[model samples]
Structures are given as structure tokens and as C-alpha cells.
Target: MKNKHLFLFILLFVGLVFILSTTYTVLAEKDRRYYENTGEVVWEIDTKEKVVALTFDDGPHPKHTGEILDLLAKYNAKATFFVVGENIEKAPDILLRQYNEGHDIANHTYTHPIKTTIPKLEAELKKTNDLIYSITGHYPELFRPVEGQYTDEMIESVVKQGYKVVMWSWHLDTEDWKDPGVHRIVKTVLKGTEPGNVILFHDGGSNRSQTVKALEKILPELQKQGYKFVTITELLYMNNENEK
Candidate 1:
């Protein structure tokens, strides 16, 4: 009797271990699958297509936005600009120019608030979407949160509004919002350059003179390496002509 009880306890222990391990694997796999597909959010695409996305945030600045646009035009490069709604009102012409030139005009927010409640978050998104629609005929499909700060509920709200939460590549962030030296900004890009990277820059929210200066080195050097600068959307769906 004693031997039988011990055998039964051992079998039950093994069964419990199996159940727990299986559950964890399934949960981990679900998470990995969620991130791999562009379901409702994106940090960076997983590919080796020699196509890098240049995304500018907090933009539509009068001077800096114009300078970045000019540089993009000269290089025959395209980029995505995450514009704030209040800044759009200030420089609607710059916003219009972004649209006319075939760049992506995504919503950053109306006021660029961080870590706010869900209701306030929705309001910010709606006001920005309305203003962007007023300026441009199309509603932006992409919305980037300020500093990429968002809760799961916030993401759910955004998804219901038909917007994708966009984040930048951790490897490619230059911290240029601090006005880091132009050389550091350029070096960060040079070191972290990879296929399917989303390089982050800003045209508003602070002095972006260093960002402007770094681009002079970045745009040309990346182009020389045979990597095409594309908008974030293009990077997401790009698979046709991937360069090895």
C-alpha cells in the first residue's frame, strides 16, 4: 500500500510539471506570433531587405521641418513624419507639403501627452485625426505615442480607431531629442545600421539643429551603401524586391 501511494504521487508530480511547461510555451509562442505580424502595433519589421525606414517625430516645425523636407527631396528619399496636431495648426503648410511630396503624415497626438488615461488618450487621438483629416483628405493610419508610452488598454483603444501603434528600433535611436552632438547622432546610425531598421529623429519638441546636421551625413552615407530610405508603411509591407 505504501509503495502504491508513492508511485501515484510521483506520477501526479510529473503530470503537473508537464502541464505547467506546456502552458508557458504556448503563452510565449502567442506573444512571439503577435509581435511578428503587424496586427495592431509595430516596433520594427523583421526582414533583411536593405530598406531602412526614416521616421521623424514631433514635427511640422516651421524651420526644421522645411530643412528636413529639402534634404529628403535632394536625396530622392522618402520618410514618415509623426506630426502633432497643435504643431500642424501652426505649420499647416509644412504639413501640406509633406502630403504633396508623398511622405507619410502620421499622428503623434494633439498635445503630445504621456502616460495619460484611456479617455484622454482617445480624445487626443480623435482631435489629431480630425485635424489631420481637415488638412489632408486621408486619415492617418499610423499613430505613435509620445515616447512610446502606452498601456494595453490604450493600444486597444487605438486599434479600434483603426490606427497602428508605431515604435522605433531600439538599436537605431540616437537620442537626438537631447540635441546630442551631431557626430554622436551620425555615429549611432553608422553603428546600428541594419536592414529593416526604423531610424528615429525629431523635427520639433526642441532644438533639432543637430538632427538637421546629422542628416547631411546620414542620408548620403546610407544611400551610398545601397540602402533605400522608405517610410514606415513601406517598410512594413516590403517583400517583393528584397536585396538578399
Candidate 2:
């Protein structure tokens, strides 16, 4: 009888531990933003190829977007732009140039809401996708949440819209949205970059002259290091190839 009682205790102890861990996991994952892990979401590609995905967020900024495009052209590099929907309405021509020049134009939600319900989030994503399709006549396959904030439900809603949710490399966020000095932005990117890195910068929602200036140095320097700048889709293609 004592042996049977001990066995029951062990089973109960294991079940309690599992319940505790699951509760912890749910708490830890809710409304958090950072790197990607163990899901359909992609944060950084896994590859040895000396290629980087340079992604700009909250953009289609009239002046800065054009300047960034010019700098990208100067280096013969490609990038992905995650454009907000309202900004797309304001700067349709800049977005047109982004598509015309063979860059990746991705959805960044309609209102850039960081805290929202699942239905609201779905509405925002669908609206942005519709706007993109209207302009480009092709739906974008990639999306990034506003401020990179999401819960599991939010992710599910985004994926249901048929987008691959993309976040930036944890180390490669240049934080140019804060108007960090041009030198600092340039240094962060140059020093933190690695193969398959997705570096983040912003061209809207703030003064982006620093970002524009930082790229003047970053693109040429990275080019010197034999890194080919690619769109997010191109980087993912390399990752898929590497798996085979």
C-alpha cells in the first residue's frame, strides 16, 4: 500500500510541474516582442551565405524613401520595405517607385496599432493587404507587426491572412526610430551584422535623416565585405535551399 501511495504522489507531482510550466509559458509569450522561435514566423534566416536582408519599416516616406532607394541603387543592393497603409495612401508614388525598382514591398498594418484584439488585428492586416494589392496588383507575402509586438493569437491571425510574419534580428536593430546619431546607427549595423541577418531601420513615424545618412556608409561598407543585400524573400529562399 505504501509503494502504491508513493507512485500516486509521483504522478501528482509530475502533473503539477507540467501545469506550472504551461502557465509560465503562456505568461511569458503573451504580448511580447523579440526574436522568432520554433514556429512559422521567421526572424533571421539560417544560412552561411554572405547575404543580409535590409528591411525598412513604417515607410513610403516621400523624401527619405526616395533617398534610401537612391543609396540602394548606388550599391546595387535590394531591400524590403514594410509600408504602413495610411502612409501608402499618402505616398503612393513613392511606393510605386519601390515596386518599380524591384524591391520587396511588404505590409506593415493599416494603423500601426501595437495593442489590439485579434479581430481588430485581422482587420488591420487585411486592410493593408488590400491597399497593397490595389496599388501593386500583387499581394505581399510578408508582414511585420507594429513595434514587433504580438501574442500567439496575433500571430495566428497574421498567418491566417497568408503572410509570413517577419521580425528583425535581436542584435541588428539599429533603433534609428529614436534618431540615434548617424555614427551610432552606422556602427551598430556594421558591427552587429552576420550572415542571414535581418537588420531593421525606419523611414517613417519619425525623423529619418539619420537613417538615410547611416545607409550612405553602411551600404558601401557592407558591400566591401562581400555581403549581398537582399529582400526578405530572397533571404528565405536561401534558407530553404540550405535545408535541402
Candidate 3:
């Protein structure tokens, strides 16, 4: 009777271990699947095709936005601009010019907050989307967090809002906010650019003399490299089509 009771106890212990192990595996598998389907927290699409996306952040600055648009037009390239909501309201003409010029305008958030808290993040994003739609008569399919700051919940919330989170694969750091020289901006972007790269730049906020200057050189140089610039939406669509 003692031996039978001991065996029964041993069986119970093994059964409990098996149940726990199975439960863990099931949960882990579900998490993995969720991440696979929804964890695309990227600023740029990753592909090997000889296409580059030039995405400017915090833009529609008065003088610089026009200069950049002219440069893009000269090169016959269509890049993406992640514009701020307040800036859009301030410079609706610049936003209209961006849309009219065939550049893809994306949301960079309403107030350009650091996204440290959930409520602030949601507010920033929603307000930006609303402003963009109000000005452009269209909804943006892409969004970039201010300073690329985000939490997992923030990312999930953005995805739920139906905007793909865009983060740069390359950092040219035009540092245009500091009014760096045009040559400095040009050299930084030219050196860092690669096929399928998403180059980060800026057009708004402060004196963007450097960005304006850099574009004059950067545009011609990129064209010479046979790099075709496309908008974020075009690139993402191309990527999705290629997957099939």
C-alpha cells in the first residue's frame, strides 16, 4: 500500500510537470505568432531592391520646404516627408506643396512629443493624423515616432490605428537643426546611403540651411548612383507584391 501510494504521488508530479511544460509551449507559440504577424516596428522597409526612400522628418518649414521640393523636382524623385501636425497647421501651404509635388506626406505626431507616456503618445499621434487629413484631404499610411521613441504598447496602438511605424535604416544626421553647412549634410548622406536605405533628414523646426544646401548636392549625386527614390507607400506596396 505504501509503494502504491508513492507511485501515485510520482505520477501526479510528472503529470503536473507535463501540463506546465505544455502550457508554456502553447503560450510561447502564440506570442511568437503575434510578433511575426504584427511586430513590424520599422521606420523603413527592408528590401534588397535597388530602391532608396528619402524620408524627411519634422518638415514643411517655410523656406527650406520649398527649396527641398524644388530639388526633388529637379531630380524627378519622390521622397517621403513625416510632417508635424502643428507645423502643418502653421504652414498649410508647404504641406499642400508637398502633396501637390507628389511627395508622400506621413505623420510625425501632432506636438512631436518624446512618447514617454501612453496617453500623451496617443494624443500626439491622433492629433497629427487629424491635422494631416484636414489639410491634405487624405489619410497618411505611415507614421514616425518623435525621436524614434516608442514602447511596445505604443507600437501596438499605432498599428491598431492602421499606420505603419517608420524608423530609418540609415542615419545621415543632417543635424539641420543646428544649421550645419550644406557640405556637411551632403557628405553625411552621400557616405551613408545604400540601396534600399531610408535616409533621415529634416526640413522644419529651425534654420534648415544645411538641409537645403545638402539637397542641392545630395540629389544629383544620388541620381548619378542610379538610385531610384520612391515614396514610403510605393516602397511598402512593392515589397508586399514581391513577397507573393
Candidate 4:
């Protein structure tokens, strides 16, 4: 009886170990794919060159959108803007300017709601996607969840509906909402930029003058540093072609 009890205990110990191992593997994978839930593209890019994709979120605001475009034009750089749907609808002309000036406009959802399991996420996404298509004549393949908030279902739904999840590799939290000074914004980006890095800047909601000012300095500085700014699609396309 003693021997049998010892064998049973050993079997239980082995079973516990196996369960723990499997659990770890599952958690790691879930973490790996968590960014996908944000309704953005999380694919890898080629790092062969000193190239980066500069992306902006939450705008097309009349106040700052035009200024942001002017700077990009001055530098002859293209960027991707994840725009809120309601904002786009209110300012179709700004959307036109973005398209006309040679930038890709992406969806950031209609209401820009926080990404919890809200009943409105699906509708919000659809509304924004539709609004963008209505004005630009094309739907952006990429998206960024409002405030970078998301759940697993949010990622799955966007993918199922045909969109790539986009996130930044370098974020100094411009806190553009708080209007951090232009010097701090420019310094943060210059100090943090790296090859194949995606930098986040903003161009909407409240005063984004600091963001506008920061770019005036950083765009030219980054050019001198030998970085080429490309829209997300162009960057991805270049990398894909190289791989082939």
C-alpha cells in the first residue's frame, strides 16, 4: 500500500509539471499576439536600411492637420495618419488635403472610444472605416485602437474584417494632450529613433501646436541623420519586395 501511494504522488507531481509547462506556452503566445487585438498591423518590417515609418494618430483636425501636412510636404516625406471617423466626416476637405498631399489615411474608429468589450466597438470601427472610404475612395488596410486600448476580440474582429494592426516601437508619450513643449518632443524623438523603428506623433484633438513645432525641428534633423521617412504601406512594400 505504501508503494502504491508513493507512485500515485509521483504521477500527480508529473501531471502538475506538464500542466504548468503547457500553461506557460499558451500565455507566451497570447502575449505575442496581444497587439493584434488593437485593430492594427503588427507585422515585422525589413531592417536592412536606416528607414522608419512615421505614423500619426487621432486627427485630421482643421487646426493642426494642415500644418502637419505642410511640414511633411516641406520635407518631401510621406506618413500614415490614423484618423478618427467623426473627425474625418466633419472635415472632408482636410482628408482630401491628406490624400492630395500624398499621405495614407487610416481608421481609428468613429467614436474613438476606449477599447473595452463595449457593445459599440464593432459599430465604431465600421463607421470609421466607411467614413474614410467615403471621402478618400479607399479603405485603409491598417488601424490603431483608440488610445492604444484593445482586447483580444477587438483584434480578431478587425482581422476578420480585413485590417492590419499598427503600433509604435518608439513612443515617448508626447502627451500632446498636455501640450508638452516643442523642445521636449523633438528631443525625445531624436534621442529615441532607431533603424526600423516606428515613431508615434499626434496631429489632432485639443492643441497640437507642440507636435507641429516638434516636427519642424525633427524632420530636417532626421533627414540629416540619414533616415528616410516612408508611409507605412510604402515601407512595408519596399521590405516585402526586398524579401522576394
Candidates' C-alpha lDDT? 0.84, 0.85, 0.77, 0.77
lDDT of 1: 0.84
C-alpha-based local distance difference test score of model 3: 0.77
Q: For each candidate, give its TM-score against the true structure.
A: 0.83, 0.85, 0.80, 0.81
- In order of TM-score, best first, we have 2, 1, 4, 3
Candidate 3 wrongly placed segments (more than 4 Å): 1-39, 46-48
Tens-place lDDT digits, model 3, residues 1-244? 9999999999999999986643422322334335435645554555777688888988778788888888898889999999988888889999988998888989888877753577777788778877878878989888887766555676678888887877776365456667767777788788887766778888888877777777888888888888899998888787678667
Instruction: Give me the runs in candidate 4 sitting further than 4 Å from their true place.
Output: 1-29, 33-40, 43-46, 116-119, 171-173
- The candidate maximizing lDDT is 2
> 216 in model 1: Cα distance from truth in Å?
0.3
Q: How many backbone clashes does candidate 2 have?
A: 0
The window of 10 residues in a row where model 4 has the poorest summed lDDT is 21-30
C-alpha RMSD in Å of predicted model 4 compared with the true structure: 9.3
Clashing pairs in 1: none
By lDDT, the candidates rank as 2, 1, 3, 4
List clash counts for every candidate, in order: 0, 0, 3, 7
How far is each candidate from the true structure, as Cα RMSD in Å?
A: 9.6, 8.9, 12.4, 9.3
Q: What tens digits encode model 2's per-residue C-alpha lDDT throughout 19-86?
A: 66434234336422342443457878777789999999998898899999999999999999999999
Candidate 2 regions with alpha-carbon error over 4 angstroms: 1-39
How many clashing residue pairs, candidate 4?
7
Q: Positional deviation of 167 in candidate 2, in angstroms?
A: 0.4
- Tens digits of per-residue lDDT, candidate 1, 163-193, equal 8778777678788998779999999998898
Best by TM-score: 2
